[model samples]
Target: MDVLLAAAAEVIALQNVAMIALGLVIGIVIGAIPGLNVPLAVAIALPITFKLAPIAGIAMLVGIYKGGTYGGSISAVLINVPGTPAAAATAMDGSQLTRQGHAGKALRMSLYASIIGELVSDIVLIMLAVPIARFALKFGPVENFALGVFSLTLIAVLSEGNMLKGLSAGVLGVFLSTFGLDPLTGDARLAFGSQELSAGWSFIALVIGIFAVSEALSMVERRGAGPIERSRVRLSDAAHRLSREDWRHAAPAIARAAPIGVFIGAVPGLGSAISAYLNYGIARALSRRPERFGKGAIEGVAAAEAGNNSVTASTFIPMLTLGIPGDVITAIMLGAFMVHGLVPGPQLFRDNAPFVAAFFVLMLVTTALHLVIGRIGLGLFIQAVRVPNQVLYPVVLALSFTGVYVATNNLFDVGVMLGFGVLGYAMNKFGFPVAPLLIGFILGPIVEVGLRQSLIIARGDLTVFVRHPISAVFLVLGVVALVWAGAREWRGGAARGASAR
Candidate 1:
């Protein structure tokens, strides 16, 4: 009871509240801009937090983390360009909804789902951190390999319409991911004798190229076409708001995704991008009208947003309970914790119970602030879709180039971005799905490293994956996912054939 009171006193301090608001605003702005991501925002704010009180400083960073995660969905809905890697999944449906003149509905769904997901995950983090972290600790290389395999099965699920093209794109992504130095050995695998190639492709540059630059190029082709006439939709004020029916469709998706996000966040290295895509695939697979996915399904936006945003709070679970960083963001937060002389292991919780309580309070407070600030900015954000195509595409092009250059400070990365932009444009022109390629790229390295390590540990015994119970479960799940997807696709094809006959 004394600890609760002490924590409450620190949390209610005006400085802490103000800093949280400031950080959230900064995060939302940076996150909404194409090419500027949350990690960069958090990194820029880290030094500034050095002078503030521990609770105040950490509160600001937490605010940024939560805000940035939600902010990515804004540009995704408006422009078909994801502001963050995780938002890529959101773009699959959010952008389509924009084209269909439901931008307001999509944006609101993203916001509401983000808030609910974050709130649920925060409560889970507070209540189950120790137990979850203990489970996370049990993940070894073999288990991780199985997990990666299960994640890769999502590519098959996503490639329902044309499995061949999807598999090819996924293979290309895995091949591209191999360009850097080998994980086991420091030696380069596919550098092709260029020093720049030795460092491999920059993830930020690739993302901006494939999504932003490619979309801009596609916009150029439609330059003569008039701007989107969103005003003609004649939506009433109530129509813009989420109805009970919308809740009925989206609530189950959010509920399903939140737990997936929390579990992924608790495990180190899985990251929000995987969670976002994984949840999206699962939601679509479970939906009665699976065809609606990738074509402006409200549930799609909710699942993606919820999956990514839920990672915001649960990511702290491992860091707080086991002193293990879940991703790059938590790694930076871990440094911030140490800077404040607040080590985050079990000892710190026992020694500074009041401070830990205070931090938890700050997280919940920041979540509420996220909702208010997001709601206030919704009107302004929706206007991005209202801009003229001729004007918007050019500006987006310049920003994509500028942001990439600023992020890497290297012309080579800019060149890489342009190169991939052409590649992405070609892929789109050929009716190929880009999502599978991205999934393969993101998971390929993890899969390779895990497989290699497991092999080494098990003396080249491939059965090591099935020998471990946790790993065996994931492997079985992967097989089940593949069989399910294949069967579903077959049934759909037969139904179509019968209709034609």
Candidate 2:
């Protein structure tokens, strides 16, 4: 009771509340801009937090994290360019909705889903952080390998009609990921004698290229073809508001994705990008009309936003309970904790119960603030789509290159971005799905590291994956999903052939 009272007193401070709001605004602006991601925002803000009180500093960072995660969906819906890597999944549907004149609806859904997901995950962190952290600790290399394989099977789902093209793109992504130095050996595998190649490709550069730059190229091509009618969001339009029916469709997806995000966040290394894609795949799989997924399904936006936003709060679970950073963002937050002389672990919780309680309160308060701010900004956010294509594309192009150089301080990365921009444009031209390639790239490292470690531990015995119950389950599920997807593709092909005959 004393702890609760103290926590309330700490969180109710005006400085803490103001700091949270400031961080959130900064986060949203950065996140909505193409090529500027959430981690960069956090990194930039880390220095400012050094001078504030511990609770106030940490609260501001938390606000940024939550806001940035949601902010990515804004540009994704408006421009078909994800502001963050995780928002790439949201772009699959949200972008389509923009083209279809439902940008307002998609934006609103993303906002609501983000708030709900963040709220649920924060509650979970407060209530079940320790237990969930303990459960996450059980995921060994073998289990992770199995999980990666299961995640890879999602490529088939994304591929659907173009199974061959999807698989090829996925394979290309895996091959690209292998170009970096070997994770275990530190020996360069595919550097091709270039010193710069030793570090492999920059993920940020690749993402900005494949999504933002490529979209700019497409916009240019569209301009050459002739004038195109762009979607405009009018305030009085019914499509701009979320109706009961839209909520009915999106609520189930949000409910399902929030927990998935929480679990993924509790486990170290599996970040928001993975959770976003996985939730999107799951939502499409369970939807009554799966065909609507890539064509502006409200549930798709909901799932992707919810899945990524939920990760924001749950990520703190491992850091707070086990002193383990869930991902790069939390790793930075861990530094903030240590800087404040608040070591996060079992001891810290016991020694500073009041502070811990206050932190949780602050998180909840941040979520409420996120909702209010997001709602107020919805009108302004949707206006991005109202810009002329010529102006918007050039600005986006300049920002894409500038952001990449600023983030990496390397000219080589800018070149890499341009190169991949061409690759992405060509892929789109050829009717290939880019999402699978991205999935493969993101999961390939995790799969490779886990497989190598498992093999080393088991003396090259592949059966070790099946020997562990958890790993075995994941493997079986992967195989089942692959086979099901193949069967569906085959049936669709056969039906097409029959109709042609």
Candidate 3:
């Protein structure tokens, strides 16, 4: 309570009006631009913020994290492009709304729903972090490994029509992760004797290749062949707000997605993409008119934005309390802490109570700022995509090249980017989902590390995984999911054969 009061005091001085307002603008712009992440913005600003007191620096980063996560939805909704994968779910229904002429209303509802989710998840993090962290502290390697497996299971159905390929991608990702020096053994695995290859692939480079450059190649292939651009007349100037019924229907969805987002985000290793997908699944599962989903359903955008933005802040809970960063981004934040000479752990919470609290306060402030920009600046975000694909495609390629350079300043990553882009475009062309590849890349390392650690602790006994109840439950669920997906695939094949006969 005292910590919050101090945070409020600091924020009140941010009553500076200019800094907060400028931060908001910077955040939105950074987020709307494809290939730029919250970390990029935060890293760029960190040196500038260093001049300020600790509270202000922390507050600005927190604000960027929150505002940037929401800002991506604006771009995703108006264009078929997702500024961030977290915004991919928003794109699902939001892009559809563009075709239906309710783009403005969809954007408005997404902004509002995002604000609601951010506020609710902030409350959950502030109030519930202790208990959750306490439980997480009890988690052994086996439990953690099983949890990682569970995360992979969520992507089983998400792989879409090519589960074997998904498995292949996942296994390859895990194998690639082994190229680095092993944590326990202090020895390299697949470095092939090159000092540079010892680091394997940089995370930023991989994301750029898969999300940005790959998107560029796919767009290039479809250049002048996409669905007609009749959507330019979307949302006449007079119709700029969500209908009462829209908000009425969206409220329940926002509520349902919030807990799911919070829980998923608070747990280490499960990021917002899975949370958004899960929320969309839940909203569709519970809807009276399930067929409305993916056909410009307002609920889809609302639930997705809610889950995505809320999880951005929610991931901090485990990070701050248990010293376990929930996602790679949060893990970077942990590194940011060490760079600032601040040790990351529960003790830091004690030493920097007010500063830590300021981080929490800024999330709410950023949400409010996002609402203002979303309502007013949304049109610009939408309009910016008016550039022709031929012109924009090069820009994406350039940015993809730049992002790759930023990681290692190496041309090898650029080559890798082009290769992955072609591979990604091939998969997309054949109607395969990209979600599994991403999930696999993100979770594979964790699963490998966890499984290795658990096995080492148990002297090579795989049975040790089931000794813990939580691990056993998750393993059981993973087994059940694999069985179900396999059975469904067999049935689908049989049905297709019968129909052909």
lDDT (tens digit, per residue) of candidate 2 on 1-501: 787778878887899999999989988988887667788889889999999999989988988898899888888888777888899899989988887777889999999999999999999999999999999888989999999999999999888888999899999988888886899999988999888778888887888899888877887886753212355556458867878988888989999999999899888999899999989988876787777888899999999999999888899988999899989999999999999999999998999888899998999999999999999999877877777776777777888888788878889999999999999999999988888888888899999999999999999999999999999999999999899888988988898899999
Write candidate 1's Cα lDDT for 1-501 as tens digits: 788778878897899999999989998988888778888889889999999999989988998899999888988888887888899889989988888777888999999999998998889988898999999889888988899899899888888878889889988887888896787888987999878878788777888899888887887886675555645433345645678888888999999999999898888988889889888988887888877888888999999999999989999998999898989999999999999999988998998888899988888889898999999888778777667887888788888888788878889999999998998999999988888888888888889999999999999999999899999999999999999999988987798899999
Query: Tens digit of lDDT per residue, candidate 3, span 300-373?
Result: 89998898877877788888887788776677667667656666578878897766787667666666666776
TM-score sort, best first: 1, 2, 3
TM-scores for candidates 1 onward, in order = 0.96, 0.96, 0.79
User: Cα deviation of 89 in candidate 2 (Å)?
Assistant: 0.8
All-Cα superposition RMSD per candidate: 1.8, 1.9, 4.4
lDDT of 1: 0.87
**lDDT, candidates in the order shown:** 0.87, 0.88, 0.70
lDDT of 3: 0.70
Scanning candidate 2 in windows of ten residues, the lowest lDDT window is 224-233
The total number of steric clashes, by the backbone 3 Å criterion, in model 2 comes to 0
Clashes of each: 0, 0, 0
